[model samples]
Target: MSLLRQLWIMVITITLLAFAGSFAVSMLTARNYLEQQLYVQSADNAAALALSMSQQSKDDATAQLMVTALFDSGHFELVRYTDVAGRVVVERANHAMPEGVPVWFMRLFPIHVGAGQAEVSDGWHQAGRVTVLAHSRYAYLSLWAGAFRLLIWILAAGLLAGIVMQLLFRWVRRPIVQMVDQAEAISERRFITITEPRVIELRQVVRAMNTMVARVKTMFAEQAARIEALRSEANRDPLTQLANRNFFMGRLAQALENEEFAPSGCLLLLRIRDLAGINRRLGRERADQFLQFVAGKLASLSADRHDWLLARLNGADFGLLAPGLSADEAPAFARELLENLAELRRIEITDESDLGTFGIAAYRHGDALSTVLTRADQALAQAEETSNAVVLLSDSDTQATLVAHDWHTLLTGALTGEDFLVASFPVLDRNDRLLHRELMLRLCQPDGRLLTAGAFMPHASRLGLMPVLDLETVRLGLVELGRVSYPLAINLSSTSIADSGFVDRLVSLLRQHRDQAGRLWFEVNEFGFRDELRALAAFGERVRPYGCKIGIEHFGRHFGSIPQLYDLQLDYLKIDGSFIQGIDEHPGNQQLIKAIVGIAEGNDMLTIAEGVHDDGEWLVLAELGVQGWTGPAATGRLQG
Candidate 1:
């Protein structure tokens, strides 16, 4: 139990104990005092009445009259006068019973006080003995009233003290709660510190935590830097800093294979001719510098395109692939790139013929990488015969590419209308137990073809409609969750996570469905998380009370150092496909997956893999302790 709760319980217990003890003692004492007063009054009254009877005639009439008068005064329960012969001359009795006190209470603490008695006498001689008893109804009534009043006071005081202690304990433990939060953050991988509190003991603890956090951050930073360096070295070319041949080929293979990018795209090659001639004239050092310059220019070209990849394919060849680009556009793209390079090297290269030529080919569905490369190479061989010739192979023809205005109009229409919705992909555990439905937003095109968020969200993001897309996604997920009993995972963009208004509205929506909040999970993409960590963490904190689980997808891709996934109390980690691909054949990736699994284990998080293909990779991942799996394999399992 929490210390605050324990303390409150202790306070209440002590209060009740003290109240019970004081109440019992007061009740017993009051009963004794009242009994004594009643007895004294009864004894004294009997003596006075006997004396009055002795002073007067001791006849039966007078005795009966006096007894009647005393009984009528209502203090005595029984009074009697007897003659010397033991014959009763006068008598009085009362049968009134006290009310307003429960029988159980009276039975629990019974008070019995006998009536008082005294001898009666005339001036020097005894007239007749007089006897009297005091009425106990009034005394019982008085005691019951006093006890009720005492109970009320005690209860009121107990309640007031309880309220005060609740507030007091919460205030006293406020700094401790913050320290606990900081510790939890550390456990989650976020090293953090807090201000020292006023209490001397708590201040010492907080200061110690702050020092520990500083050391942990330093330690993790050094370790993360080493891992990041190794990862970068494994994928990047040393000289140009572009993706190495293996990495480039892997991406190229996926581009040709992935369902999202296979439909329409272009692969272009820029070949530098007479490399030996230029290297001999410029020397190896200048030639290397020239190659680096060219690599930089090619890298700069990718900045404008939404989905693009550039790589150093080989010593003399460089490759650029533009996904979602149609056929005819490849020519202008090829021309613009060559023109930029020529303008850049215009002063350096005196002869325009010294510049390289371009060979481009547009790819459609079911096109093989080898076939496309052959087509581009044939075009390059033809271009090599001419000066600064840019060749578009026979395969490269026109199919229309939608302009930006068209996308804006289509996406805007879908949002304002009822066409915007989401489709869920299943996430299953190792035992094929369904975990959740991963909701991906979809836009129903006018042609009745459903377009995935991957198809339109890029343009939406650039146009600052990410927040709108996120809001619609959340709405769709909530409505979907209500229809199903299983949990659902919703993706929130960085823009929506950072937008205060969006967060406020989203939180309110979650609250309105508070009962089902636990069944709804939220996740942001890896890049989105990197875009705004603090905002995401704060947003998670706000919704945490509603029982929503938060985590990142495409995890461990750019993990140079663990981004405070621990701090977020992340529910699960989905390993990116880059590491998951061909894992059975890649020992290095297996080790990387093991390392990621270790991190998740330490943080008490669930680990899953994305884009899983082979059964061997799945088995390897399962042996690596991945609790859940997603992607095509898991999807197929769900469907089966």
Candidate 2:
């Protein structure tokens, strides 16, 4: 039982005991007072009646008349007159029960009094003794009235006391309930604190809990900082603070192969014109400073573009990977970079107006890395030969030149026709047990060809049609879940989650399909999630009651934000494919994956490796404590 209930019981018991004690004491005191008054009245009446009888005639008729008169007038139970030889001369008696009082009351608190007796005297001679007894009916009535009034007063006081105690209990219960919620949050790896109550004991407990939460947050921050540093050391260029060549190449390959990435994009390469000659003219220190200046300018230019990857390819070469950039936009993007580079010449850092040359190559999905590099190199050669600041090269046959209007029209038609397909990919645990199937959405074209999300999602986002598309995907997922026995996970765009209307509709849909809600998982890419944490948290709160789970996909790219996840209470983290590829041979990636697994486990989140291509990668991820994985290897396992 709850403490509040126990306290209520104790209060009731004490109240009852007090009422009993007061009732017993007051009734007994009233009884004693009534008895003494009755005895006094009986004695006085007896003496007075005897004196009057003695003063009058002592005959039987006179004595009888006087005794009868005294018994009738003085409210006496009995009146008697006796001769000097102890013979009764006359007697009068009346017997009647008390009225207007309960029998039980009388039995519990019956009144008792003794009869009074006195001698009659005439001229100093003792006459026959006269005895009289007073009636107790009036006394019983008075005692019953007083007892009833006492009970009424006691009941009113007890009720008032009960109300006061209830209010006090509620006031104390509020803080206790908050503390309990805080403890539960901590157990779930979501550290939270409660306000200290006015109660000294409870206040101390809350203070201790808050202190512990703060300490744990600090520890998590330190660990996240360490992991972020490790990631930087392995993937970042030391001088430019941009991604190194190896990391850039890995990410480019991932983008090319991953179905979730855009089908085609542009790659730009910038090279310093004669770095050796600049080093001879200017000191090595000055030339290094110039390179740093150029890198800073590039970083600043691409700061707003989260999808763009900037990297230092070599000593005097920098590469920028802009996914989803169309061939039409390639010239403007190159011109912008050239303008930024022109700052070096305008500032007189380099005398030559042409401080660098740019080579731009537009690539399609499934294109070889070496082939793309050779294309960019040919563009660079053309720029160097033609004395132009920028040159663009593209394979028109492979790359589809879809304009923004065409994308908008296609996506709108697809949405209207409900031409969307969901493809399920299995995620398996170490023991080859299925955890859940990740759902990928595909758009069906007029020609009966299927297009992956990467092909049209960027356009959908630009057209502000993500909410409708995402909602339709969720509706499809719910329908699919009704047919399958296992769980299904669908990715939601950050833009869709940020829309209040979309979240409300999604939550309403989940409420309608309550049975399938528990088996549904929603994931947002880490890049999008980092910017929309507040919106994501609100969405989680709205759907958490229905047992829906929220997770982050491609998680390792934002290792610095790990500490911020304490409040999210996420269900899982899918490490980015860039870190998972060739993990068996890369010790640096192995340590990074291990640290990620440790942090996720500490927060009670499941870690799943994305893009596990081969058995070697799978074995390494399993040994590194990854709970689940999905990619070619996982698909092959399901097939086998």
TM-score of each: 0.66, 0.91
lDDT per model vs. reference? 0.77, 0.86
Report clashes for each candidate as comma-separated counts. 2, 0
Candidate 2's C-alpha lDDT? Answer: 0.86
User: Who wins the TM-score comparison?
Assistant: 2
Q: Write the per-residue lDDT of candidate 2 for residues 468-547, one digit (tens) a residue.
A: 99999999999999999989999999999899999999989999999999999999999889889899888888999999
The 10-residue segment of model 2 with minimum total lDDT is 556-565
Which regions of candidate 1 fall more than 4 Å away from where they truly are? Answer: 1-181, 187-189, 196-204, 253-263, 304-306, 343-353, 364-382, 393-399, 556-564, 623-625
